[model samples]
Target: MNNNVKASINAVIVSAVFGAVQVANAAFIEDSKLTLGMRNFYYDNDNREGGADQREWAQSFKLDYSSGFTEGFIGFGVDMQSLVGIHLDGGKGYHPDSNTFTPSDSDGSATQEWSSFGATAKARISQTEFRVGNTLTPSLPILIATDSRLQPQTFGGAMFTSKEIDNLMITGGQLERAKGRASTNSTGLSVPGGTEESNHFRFAGADWKVTKDLMLQFYYANLEDFYTQHFFGLIHIQPLGERQSFKTDLRYFKSSSDGKNGEPGYRFNNNGGYAKNPGEVDNTTAIAMFTYTFQSHSLMVGHQRVSDDGSLVWLSQANVVNGSGRNEGEGGISFYSFTDAMIGNFARAGENTTFGQYTYDFADAGISGLKASISYLRGEDIKAVSGSGPDLHEVETDLRIDYVVPEGPLKGFGTTLRHGVYRGGGTSIDDQDQTRLIFNYTYSFF
Candidate 1:
């Protein structure tokens, strides 16, 4: 880690210890909770074409500590998170020298191990809470942290949330930097093809429950010199019978160019797809999803359409290099859309995607703690990068199974297996098949 990060962590530790001792209250000590989480992951990818395959296995440990608020009208507390990852196996030629899964050594090989540490200080008053920290993980409609890898990505920022009104929640925040999942350092925010970094990311949103089964959402976000985005969402559920229900979800996004966007070094790649105005952000996306549940089965279907002007935009630091002129493995992002699939994101320009999923809960069949799901997505009418050619196409299918040990010595232990197959034509993405197996367990201490 760098000197700045080390100093921040040390200061947090000192403050946490001193504050707890000074308070000397039951709420601060007796209600504190700590948990240790472990995950073992194995990943494999096979390229159908003559490309390099990626296979890696690793184990990660996370220590999370949360302290209860002190006794006061304005309660105060602290939270800390520590993570460590160890590479178990990734033979030569199998582990690519990319920050996608693991940090790379100077020799272009996987690093043996990596670790990170962060802390947050928070205060609560009435129905509102304010927090400032380097471990913020926001799940707003405009920006969502990525946690698909061994470590969850984190942001350094300050935020506030208010729930003073019944059935209403308001949230806003400003994030300055982000820590990549596979690296120990933090970097500024940018987009997929942006080389220059921007430290300002501001967002505000509200969720209002209009009725017992209907909710509405609206949010706005801006990334300095990158893009400004607005989001709207609606969700409704209708009960059909004792064991059956239907859900409807709708989402829409509008994005446009921000300050200095389309300039050299701050260009948007349009997700490597077509762009009406090269390097400029101008797009709108609409999505609708419906789900029906009956007994032990659930089915979901969705459709998404991207504007013909540009691809969708989101906050990313993938292309930003650290001071050492090397990537810090900060390359994964999650958008609040169903098109953000396991193997591919179907958010290219002028693209139309149709997708569906089927899931089963084995508990209804006397097999508790077991579940399975399969999904498929096809994207067509994708404009080529040149903006004047035959439309491109891509498809992906994913299968997943999950199980947890229940009512046994290994209770709470969980296992997951996932496989995805992707095929594409006339796009930069290649055909590939990927699989992942993961084991997770956590123990708590109070």
Candidate 2:
């Protein structure tokens, strides 16, 4: 975290601690909530090629507490989160040197366990709220926190949201550091293949609900010394019948190099694809998706296109080393793209991808809490590293099923099964089949 943010957080904490004792009231104590969430995750990967496979099983627990605002014109509250991960199984050979699944020990084996704690201080006035902490998980167009593993990624920073204007919502923030899903340490932010860290990330965005069925969004983000990005999006829904609807979603992004982008310690890998200026950031991407739903069945189809200049860019710290000169176990990230698949993200330069998904809900068929989905994506014309020769191609197929107990003793218990197959030619990625089984439950204390 940055010095300014640390100072602000410390002041907020001191104020909140002393003020609560003096003005503890009904709204603050009565409306508080607490919950404990448990997850058991099993991951298995079968490398079709002659590569090492990864298999691991782990258990995670998360405790969350949120207190309501104190009764007044200017209200104050706080939120706390604690996460613990236990490495149930993952032997020496199965645990890779990378920190994609579990933290590694000094001997390159899985660590026994890891844990972290964070707190957020918040204040509200009218329809605007401000927050600062290390536990912010933002899911916006420019940034998305990764939560596909044992724990969710978090950022250390400050943010604000305002709904003061009718039909409009505004959000903005600045982040300085991030805590990876598998590691207990926080590190400076950077892109893939960037060894030097950039401590400043700033963004602002707004969403406008123009009508009951239409919405528009715009956002701008910049990672200091890395890249700057702008996003535009549109979403619309048309009701065809009482039980039928059609949805349209469109998105576009334009990114370019920022200060010191192509320098030695700040080079971008372009997602391991060809870049026009080698380590520079330059890219434009567009996507359009349509979904039609009828009763319990829904189908979605989308197409995405990437410019020939470079691959898409987003915030990442996977390649940044820690003080001990070892990998920081921060190898995963989530982006705001439909091509972010189970095993591969088809955002290579000059790549054109088409994808489709089919989903079914069993509620109408007497199984109230069952849902299944299958999706397929194929990308062609991927630029080779040499920027010459034959183009590369890749494909991925994923299948997922989820079920929850509806009315039994384990009413809130849920299970999910997911499988993915990925195949590629002329790329660094290996052909593999991956499967994941997850069990989840949450208990609330009101």
Candidate 3:
């Protein structure tokens, strides 16, 4: 973290402590909650075509504390989190540059250990709350924090959420920096092919529940010097029978170039595609999904479409956006989309993806703590808008199973297994397979 950022966070912490003490209310301490979580993760990836396999094993500790508000017209609270990762395995050549489970060293190797600390100071008035500092996961469709790795991603920013009106939520935020999932340092924001770092990311959105079964959403986000994006969404659920239901989800995003997009250090290649308006952002992406559920079984089908003019845009600090080669750890990012799957995002220019999944709960068969799911995504008819070479295609399959202890001393313990297979040509690697095993346990102290 930078010195100025550190100082600002410390100042906020001190102010929050002082405010709590001055309020003379025990609610801040009486309603506080603390949790100690442990995660053991093992990741293995194999290139079916060639190259060495990538494998890494690590143990992570997460300490989280959340305090209730102090008494008053405006209540004050604080939230703190500390994450530590200790490497258990991953010998020489096991840690690939793209692997984000462990921190990368100066020599492109995995470090033995890494850690980070963050805190959020918050105030609440009525149904609205304002917060500043590190928020682990943001509930925004334009940006998402990846938690698939050992340590989840976090952003340093100030955000406000208002739920004063019934069935309506208003959210807006300004984000300046982000700490990657594996890195201890924070960096500015940019897209995949953007070389310039834009510290300012602004977004505002609202969600309105029109009825008990339908909701509408509209959001706008701008990444300075990168792109401006707008999102529109609709979700509806219908009950068919006593044990049957159906759901519909529709999402759309339109993005255009912002300031300095075509200038030096701000140029984008559209993720190596032929951008119709070179260095300028212009794209539209849409996805629709329908699901049917009956008792213990659920099935879904979805399709995603990307405009030919340019690729989709989201904020990511990866690829050394500022043209600095010193920070390689900030290479992992996640976007808010259904296609952000286990193996691939399937979000290239001109790509049309069709996918499906089937999930089942083993409780129907007397196994109360087990669930399994499998999904497949196929993308085709992809071509550059500038009339580049041949059209591209890709395919991915994923399988996942989770188990949680039902009771006894290990009630909060859980185990998850995931496997994925990816195959493609342009913009994607050759044939590849990946597997992950995770064990997690959390204990809470009030």
lDDT (Cα, 0-100) at 358 in candidate 3: 99
Local distance difference test, candidate 3: 0.86
Q: What global local distance difference test value does model 1 have? A: 0.92
Cα RMSD for predicted model 2: 7.5
> What digit string (tens of lDDT, one per residue) describes model 1 on residues 275-323?
9999999999999999999999999999999999999999997475655
TM-score of each candidate? Answer: 0.94, 0.94, 0.92
Per-residue alpha-carbon lDDT of candidate 2 for residues 48-164, written as tens digits (9 for 90 to 100): 997999999999999999998886788989999999999999765887778888887776788888888999999899999998999999999999999998888999899999999
User: Runs in model 1 with CA error above 4 Å?
Assistant: 1-24, 323-325
Rank the candidate models, highest lDDT first: 2, 1, 3
Q: Deviation in angstroms for 64 in model 2?
A: 0.7
Name model 3 segments beyond 4 Å from true: 1-24, 321-326, 384-386
Worst 10 residues of 2 by lDDT: 317-326
Question: If both were scored by lDDT, which would come out higher, candidate 1 or candidate 3?
Answer: 1
Cα lDDT, model 3, residue 169: 98
